[model samples]
Target: MKIDARSTARTLAEIGKWRGVLLYGDDLGLIRERAAQCVRQIADSLDDPFRVALLDQEQHGRVEEEVGALSLIGGRRVVWVRDAQDALLPRVTSALAIDSDTVLVIEAPGLASRAKLRSALEAHPKIASIGCYPEEGRTLIASLSDLFRDASVAVDREALFWLSSVLGADRAAVRSEVEKLVLYAGEGGKLSLDDVQDCIGDSANATLDDATTAAMAGDRAVADIALERALADGLSPIALARACLSLMTRLQRVLDWMDEGKSRQEAIKLLKPPVFFKKMDSFTKALERWDGAGLRRACEAVQGFELACKQTGCPDLALSRRLIAQLCLGPRSFLR
Candidate 1:
């Protein structure tokens, strides 16, 4: 069965009717989330050692073996394969070919549309295939509204739009943000755009985002506060450096768009995994300090800093802070 990602909840409602399920897509959080949801539908609990089996790429060949075995407690077995690839198609096909109560779920990330494994499973009458791409804006907003309604939080359309734009990439992040918003608003409280922005942008995750933008914008005071808070909360220095690198890459793409004669708004409209609404203005300002060479320099600095963190006896935390501080100065000021 070819099930649409948007229809996963409805499909999962009937999960027991399917012999096999293949969950693959770009949105890893969604893929894993839906996979777990399906498992919970078919099984009593994931924690039961005798009833559930967790497999990965390294344990590829054993899925069929585990499913075929007789359970100690005689319960229907649940076999989950993570990071599955096309090579496992034969096993999946053979396993699903049997009429059994055992459930098989595979998490295959980045499987091509034309991949033989996916096609093979889709062709099977008993198998269900779903692509868990990032949720569309409307779908995301609707889900957010549903959550808000359940929590008795009154949400305005503008606030929903703000959330939709900010959290299109990761469902887990979006869900977490919404929960915080509901809590922040309390029961039966009206939510506005400012409330959404205040709650989402002031989160722990947002602290890292603020640090990334402030570092790029060369705002010494803001950078210090953001970095200090993030570190105090146990965020590692290398991890923070990597976030800066990812942000820089996105800024570079925006720069490329600008160079091609697109207006800033037009360029931003084309970015994938979008710049969050709260950080959009800061990100735009930060890009003004760099061109192609400068962006390249920033990437190089982050890469070098990553290597230093791996070196023997390196003062990684302190070194990372220094490297990011230098990057705050702009690309032409690259540390020699």
Candidate 2:
């Protein structure tokens, strides 16, 4: 059966009842984390030699043998296969038919939605197929807010917004950063935007943010300098293009909300992964300069920019700079 994200913890607690589980998604960190949780559910320790059998891409052929083997310690066993692929489907099917007490946990972090292995697992009555996609939008914001609340850390709303916008897509990385922030803050400590920035922000992301903000606000010199620094710091042209598209997407969303009768301030505030407070003035300026139709065109162009960056022998850096310049000059100039 397929497992919903919300019910994953509840389902994981009873994972032993399933013959096997297939964990797959874009979030490798989440897949690894959930796979560990499944192993812990069945064993005393992760490295327990007697109760847990660890297999990798090359050792997946041992899955059937491991799943059917009796635990020497007289408890249920767990056979974990990492980076699993469709080639192991037959072995997994054989293991499933063994009627053994052991549970097979397959970790395929990048499995396709319609892959035979994923489809088989999802359709099986005795197996669970759980996707570990990255959380975004309000769900991510809420999750980060809960993390801070649970840590007894008082974070300013804008600080939370910045953190979520920047790091919330990677579950493991965000959690690690949040732990660092919590330690930096100490128990019951308060975190302002500056505090969080000092604790968790890196130069590369900060440079990218500066570039996007400056470009949107029509500050070409600052945008060019920041973009140069970002590229010099080893950030890819594709990443820069994506960053611009993301900012434009957010701005377009705010415009959509305004069209729905919300005030501009209300619409901006309603943005998930809210705009950084420090960038509010520049963000507002960009908003004033672009309406729904212009933003729509800008978004389409930025997407094309990203595609161009991916082509072989394309002048990625030049295209990236040109895209930024065009954005700074406004859609009217580029559309011409």
Candidate 3:
């Protein structure tokens, strides 16, 4: 049977008692967390400890042998096939057909409506396919409330929005941020925007924002400082490269929309995560300073730096520092 995102966790916990279960989702973190919980519960209930095998693409052949083995101590067994790809569908299907006390949990990527594996799982009564799409606005708010309630802290709606906007769609990051806020607030305390800014606010994000903002405003010194801080924070060279490329991409898109006569408000409205109203001015200035050609060149430079970091095997901190320095000194002709 298929389970919607809302009921997935509860359903998985309950279904684990059965002989077999198939858990698949797009989010690797959520999938592994839920699957591990289920497996632990099943192991606890068995008379003898079960063998847990984590199968991957390289270990596809081992599935058949593992599935065919009789429980050594005559208790429940579990085989976890993680990161399942299309190549293993036949083997997985065959293994699932075996009538045994062992539970096989196959975790795969997200599936479209017409996907064969999804169709097979949907058809199988013992199998369940769960979708773990990023939470929407209301869902995120609800999740935040639950997280705060569990931590014995209260978050005002405004603070929740601030957290959500800053963290975007990363559930794990949001949970961590909430924990940081709770710790900062201490016991029996309420969470506020300032509390969040003080504790959970990432220095890298702030520095990146500042650096981009300074670059937009033509303040090289301020931009340099911001980039330096970001590098000092142990940000990877590849990560910095990606961030710079991402900013350039956003700037280019904003420029394209502006060229088509779209107002900044309208363009922001159409963008994912919906750029905050306060950031609109900064975004506009960045877009003005870095047009399409400039953005493309920045992307190319970052890519080259990323390749160098990988090839040189430099420490992440050293690589990031060098890359940031290069970016600071690199030609701004791309912004032309």
Candidate 4:
């Protein structure tokens, strides 16, 4: 049967009752997490030699054999298949027919809706199918709030908003960062906006963001410092170039909104993946300094930097520096 999102938690906790489960989704992190929970439900340690049998695509042919075999330790066993593909459908379908207590947990990242394996699992009487997609917007905010609440940490609404806005494109990264916040807060600690920033906001992405924002605002010194700090943090030059390109692309969209007779605030609000609340003011200031034509020129210049950074043996750092210099001086300073 297909597990509803509302019942995923309850179902996961009672996973031992199911013969097999197909954990498939765009969020590989969530898929891995759910698979781990299932593994723990049936076996003591994730690495329990006798009870846990790990499998991959190459070894998937042995899934049915593994699922049918009893644990030498005299308890339930778990068969974990990682990075599963549709070709394993027949084996999984056949394995579900076994009357053993062992449970099968399959992790299939980026599984298609109509994929044979997915369809078979969802329709099977003894199997549960769960889709693990990334959380966003209010869902993301609520999850973050619950995570903090469960840890007995009191986080305010504004702090939650800031976190949801900047946390992740994947559940694993969000979980890792949340663990850091929990540790930083200690027992019964209250998390303020400053606390969250100090713990979760000190990331390489933040430094890159600082560089792009300062570069756009013509603060050459701050831009250079942030760029150097990001590089020191081990972010690749190609990553830095891409960050600049992404910001310029967003600014161009903001200009498009403004040209449509929208006010500056309205245009900024229209930006998808909305600007980080703390950086809103600086982003606004930078947007105000550019018109449509100039913003378009800046976007094209940043694109060129991105392309150059991708070339083999390119002096990516120097090219990135020159691009930032011109961006700080506005688009007319582009090198021929």
Per-residue C-alpha lDDT of model 1 across residues 181-254, encoded as one tens digit per residue:
88899999998888777877655443556677888888777777877776675555555565677678788888
Stretches of candidate 1 off by over 4 Å are 72-75, 149-153, 185-190, 203-336
Worst 10 residues of 1 by lDDT: 164-173
Assess the local accuracy of residue 237 in candidate 4 as a C-alpha lDDT between 0 and 100.
58
Candidate 2 residue pairs in clash (backbone atoms < 3 Å): none
For 1-336, candidate 4 gives per-residue lDDT tens digits of 999999998999999888989998767777888899899988967999899999987899998899899888799999999988789988887887777888999999867788898888898877889989767666777788878888898997777877865554367767878889999999799989888887775663445667878888788998898778766755455455555666777888888888889998898888766777777876887787766677777777777776676556888888878877888887567534
Q: TM-scores for all candidates?
A: 0.60, 0.75, 0.58, 0.67
Candidate 1, residue 170: Cα displacement in angstroms equals 1.7
* Highest-scoring model, TM-score: 2
How high is the lDDT of residue 187 in model 4? Answer: 71
For model 3, the stretches where C-alpha displacement exceeds 4 angstroms are: 17-26, 44-51, 68-75, 110-115, 182-189, 204-336
Clashing residue pairs in candidate 3, if any? Answer: 294-334
Report how far off residue 332 is in candidate 2 (Å).
8.0
Off by over 4 Å in 2: 146-158, 186-194, 201-249, 260-263, 285-336
- lDDT for predicted candidate 2 compared with the true structure: 0.81
**lDDT comparison, 3 vs 4, better candidate:** 4
**lDDT rank, highest first?**
2, 4, 1, 3
Candidate 1 C-alpha error for residue 310, in Å:
24
Error of 1 at 271 (Å): 16
